[model samples]
Target chain A: MSKSVRKKPAAPKKPVAPRKPAAGKKPVAAKKAAAVKAAGMAKQPDIAPLLTVSDIHTYYGDSHVLQGVSLDVKPGECVALLGRNGAGKTTTLRSIVSLTPVRRGHVGFDGLDITHSPTHRIIREGIGYVPEDRGIFSSLSVREHLDIALWAAKKPPERRDEVLKIFPRISERLEHFGQQLSGGEQQMLSIARALLAEPRLLILDEPSEGLAPIIVDEVRDTLARVKKTGTSILLVEQNVAMALALADRVVVLSQGMVQFTGTPAELEAQPDVKDTYLGIA
Target chain B: MTFFLFNLLNGLQLSMLIFLMAIGLTVIFGLMDILNLAHGAFYMAGAYFGYVVFQATGSFWIALAIAPLLPLVLGFLLQYFVLQPLIDRGRSAHLDMALLTFGLLFFTIGLIDLVFFETLGLTFMSIDKPAGLGSYVNIGTFYPSYRLFIIAVGLLVALIVWLLLERTVVGAVVRAGVDDREMVRAMGVNVYVVFASVFALGCGLAGLAGVIAGAELSINITMGVQILIPTLVVVVLGGLGSVKGCFFGSLIVGMTETLSQAYVPALALFATYLILAAMLVFRPQGFFGRTPKSV
Candidate 1:
């Protein structure tokens, strides 16, 4: 070994894949993790699955969307929901939060059925939703947004400091109105506001839709960091590379049905699935 | 000069009474976005209910306590059976709902008119003067103590309302909901409950204002439209849903109306319309109201 090996200032980027496990279903996840290790990565933590949505039907007035969507997210794991445009992915997220009127089936989060509960009640039951459009009050400043969020949720006052740590950008833009921020800044504030709610599960719909690649990478990194802090995530993303790299498990929805659910290795191996669905062949 | 002081006191009392009436109207309009022309009917109901109570038990105090409750209960039932459905189905239009409430107003007013004649009925009813202060006081000139009390109470209520809106979370949500109902509802708040509660509260305030007016002045069927127009002006002038704005607007309207009647005899004929015209020319959205944001 060299006497003075130059140490990098930041953590090294480890390879994201391992080895293909034994053929014919020896726990799809184990094989996937093995593939991740074979590609040169340490063993990640095994988190419990926190949410299980099954055959959920949602509609918007007369529009029949979210036909029979089903997915699960393990506790402290980042689960990415990928789909094509108008594949009812956003409707699935909204239905889970009880913002959209549900027609049938169940959404179980933290071992409680919340398919029929009101949005505010769902919020109180510990699920934070960052909507696709980023619903921030244009007139409210960053500080005021946090103040109103906590007050409305009847949450304790001290989470404000904890929120600032994750979103130092919001702390910096404390006096800026929601409308005053750039697109990337508003996205950061929206995610930060949701995190301040201190939910066990955070459902973010299309967080990387319009941001620059660098900003998208920052969001991807933040999700990874927050997952480490024990907040499980249900992420919906259009960026295939970001989804595959960051998610512990990937669930693909096509026309409101789960088309494929597996780890990134299986998805990478299935070239046909990638080519047909995402145009990524 | 003594006559001027008397008129000033009279004006203050009238403003305070109108403030009570307009608070309910503005709250329902601003928060719920429901046009309720029948709000004036609540005032009429209070006057009639107070008269009935005053007749039943020769006690003005009991009438004061019981009179407002009847109209409040009536408002709740009306909302539940009538207005709520209209608002829920997205059928709320200014002219349509205005006509609906106006019909209810006429029906209620006519019912009372039939029962108690066109003239002020129940001759035994008289407000007991606040003792010690008597009817008049000389503060350099002369003032009515009862009218002064009424003005004090009105200002106190307005201050309390301002505190509720500025300091409390529920009030903050109400104000936000007023500007943007969909935004508030999308944030997981049940704006329907907020609307119902605010409607009841506004109508309740109107009823109480009616009882006070009935005691202070004469109660008649014709009082509804005549008083309603001025109160609407006050609400608009103060900026809808802004208590501070309403307070200052009320004082301005009150002082102008009072002074014009006393000092300028010829001007009194066109005084209310004159103020309305000037305000329209200067500030169409009222003095304190901000320009509404595009949805």
Candidate 2:
């Protein structure tokens, strides 16, 4: 009993501090609202920003994973959260979904303060989580996986049709168990399962991890098609080239702090930013 | 030949009784990951309550109905009030829960032992053999009507449980939960509610089994131990989480125990354990159940 309780101290500390505000200015909720209003400014863009995670500090125990991370995506925008390994990229996505239990700053989704809401409540509020590990129910089949996800998400029937269209790989193997799928196929199923939820905000953590190069390209294409339908996506990927080509905006973190945030063009011109943080010359 | 037929019928009834105990145990262990040793105590409580209610009202029917329902409510309260707090604290280990339940088991059984020492062996005082069907019926051999009723009731209950689990939306959620409870919670079905409901259902079934078994075998405080070991063996043999597996495992254990008792009385003492050992060697996870899993 003491052991389980003792192991959780580091996990709880990160979530509570993040539940407040980072660096003590305004609460994260206020900053998130301000970010969304700033996003709504016509001079910036016309697309409605569905989620804004701004100036957030997140930690896993004493390890500061996401430092001062800020990113936003419009209702139909696809923003890639890109960085090298240990760049706090996945932690940024986790903070936005309230999975990692953020320490500082706030996340606003669809203009609601969801920084402290439970993960289930957040998902119900139209945010879907696809973890880096795929988190598939191995015992259940493809059809059963979708069935549970859809049951939980309570999406309209049309969304299932759209999901099947997005990932035809799963349509052919609905009865196959999740564990039976190959790496690429499992990745596809993970994305497909999340898509069936019809979330307004889809936060995917390292979707391309552990996949063959060809399969990675197929996943990228699938994400692109999904973006075309006006679903806002926050994609965390180490594959920088694909992200640069796909994202409307890019946010990079170095040592748990935001080093750069800009469009693909601005990021391309900053060689020092790339070399110092990404180890890319 | 007559002796063989008689033992076969008795074995079938015993298997059914044990299946009721196991189905609940397996589901609770598989999905909630909680080790419950006091489940037999709950079964005993049902028999005690049934015994009292039958004596007071002299209505076997009311006692049977109230017996299971009382235990179901007790289980729900225990899970909600007691287990939930421990689970919230992350201190609800299998060893801890088993120890806690052991205390409860001893308390409940002791209370019953004190209350009705003489009436402990009473069996189905309210239910009588149907007048026309009381005599033995020959189907290549003769068997009592009451014994056949027990078999028929067990099969019907098993079928209902299977249909409900396989062909319902709730069943889909439950199946998913057994594999990945944390994910199920993240997916937004108040997991506590599901857990409590399943716990109650499992306990309710146990109590119902007690009521049914009371109709077949004599009820006593001693019945708990007699049923528990074999029931657990059946669950392990069937597969930890498979309802269908439990059904088949019960049959195997039942037949083996019955035959061993009749044909080889000397081996009867170790018969159930022998079958369990053989099954463990061949299929450690049980006949229809999957391998011991970590969700």
TM-score of 1: 0.74
Would you estimate the TM-scores of all the predictions? 0.74, 0.81
Clashing pairs in 2: A17-A103, A18-A102, A18-A103, A18-A104, A67-A256, B237-B286, B237-B287, B239-B289
Q: Write the per-residue lDDT of candidate 1 for residues A1-281, one digit (tens) a residue.
A: 10111222334333223222225522212111212122211223333236767677887777778877767776666788887898888888888887676798777765566777767777766677777877666655667667667775666878888878887887899888767987788788778877777777888988887899999989888888877777878888898888777786677777777666666666776777677666788
lDDT tens digits by residue: candidate 2, B1-295: 8888889998898788888888888888877877667788878877767766766776666877888988898888888789877976667778888788878878877777776664454332333333554577887688877778778878987888787677665676677777766566666566677778888988888888877666556777777767878887887788866889889888988888988999999998898898889888998877776543312
How well is each residue in B1-295 modelled by candidate 1, as lDDT tens digits? 6787778887888888888888888777777666688888988888778877877876767887888887788777777668877865557777777889989989987887777764645333334443553577778776767677778779887888777776676776766665655446545566666677777777777877877777677787777776788887887787777777777777777777888888997887778777878888888877767544411
**What's the distance in Å from true for residue B225, model 2?**
3.8
What is candidate 2's CAPRI-style docking category based on DockQ? Answer: acceptable
Stretches of candidate 2 above 4 Å error?
Answer: A1-28, A32-49, A52-74, A83-108, A111-116, A156-158, A253-260, A272-279, B56-62, B111-135, B278-282, B291-295
| Model 2 lDDT, residue B108, Cα | 77
Candidate 2 residue B287 C-alpha distance from true site, Å: 3.1
Q: Which runs of model 1 end up more than 4 angstroms from their true locations?
A: A1-59, A65-74, A82-87, A104-113, A138-144, A168-189, A208-219, A237-245, A249-281, B1-12, B49-107, B110-129, B132-134, B139-141, B182-193, B248-295
Candidate 1: DockQ? 0.18
Per lDDT, the best of the predicted structures is: 2
